[model samples]
Target: MDLTGYPTDFVADLGFPGAARRFLERRARHWPRLFLNGVPLDDTALGGWQLPEEPDTSESSILGFARDAAMEQHWEDEGYALDDTGEGPFALFYSRYGRPLRAGAITGVAGVPEQVAESVESIGLMLSGFFVVSLLTPDDPATDPFSESVLRDLRESFAE
Candidate 1:
């Protein structure tokens, strides 16, 4: 579907641009497949191949409405918020922002997991498939372009 990843600047500002890049690295030394239940992510626009199911949301929020559905309907089965809970949807979102569900360079979150989680939910609710958050969607192919490009940019910026 030609999904658009996050801008390079967004990842860099989070402080783990390199890790995020490596997380998305396509190099042989690096793993590209973001698998879950041993199955490749065929539904992904970025061709995730597969990523292990994270403790957080499973489907990449950047993929589209269906992915977002999976996130809210399935991933947060334990709980994000509740009309009953009354903590507000923001409570769950706070737990997910920028936190890596799966540990790695690219998947590594630049912000706090809770914050990223909350943001993901908020983004999903407000922005839907168009959500453009790196922390909320580190595995999203749309999170950063070519992982390598983002990493190179980060390295250059860091060096300077």
Candidate 2:
């Protein structure tokens, strides 16, 4: 999938800061690949990916989710985790199949690419993949389009 339009759409939907916006815009050229257990993620594995019962945002809610023993166990069982920095404001979404996905950029951190690398290394399997549309020098590929409902809710949250 051509994610050429994702950064623009994400900014339009979430009004992300300039840094995050720049990251996605700069990285849109790459392709996203979902990985599981250090391998390519597939539909069968995605089948186990689940959306939270209620609306959630990565910055505010997903930390709790990622840290939850039960949720962590579930993601471990599925061989992946949509990791969050517990710092940057990430927008969370579900795939059409209901698999959790995340998009965001981190800025103001010196040596950001290295920073993201360190974060990923620390989390290990807790992070499955990075969005191709990202700030990193070479972002991940296009895995799947984000869920419309999640985008809508994010927009609405901004409105409120």
lDDT of 1 by residue, 1-160 (tens): 2322233323223333333333333321222333332233333533443322233332333211112233334334523222222211111011113342221223333344777755554231221111113322222224334433434433444343
Q: Tell me the lDDT of candidate 2.
A: 0.29
Kindly give the stretch of ten consecutive residues in candidate 1 with the minimal lDDT sum. Answer: 87-96
Clashes of 2: 6
Predictions: Cα RMSD each: 17.6, 18.1
lDDT measured at residue 38 in model 1 versus the true structure, 0 to 100: 26
Give the worst 10-residue stretch by lDDT in candidate 2: 132-141
- Clash totals in order: 27, 6
TM-score of candidate 2 on Cα atoms, chains taken together: 0.22
lDDT of each: 0.30, 0.29
- Compute each candidate's TM-score over C-alphas: 0.18, 0.22
**Candidate 2 lDDT tens digits, 104-148:** 543333323775766654332322322212211011224423223
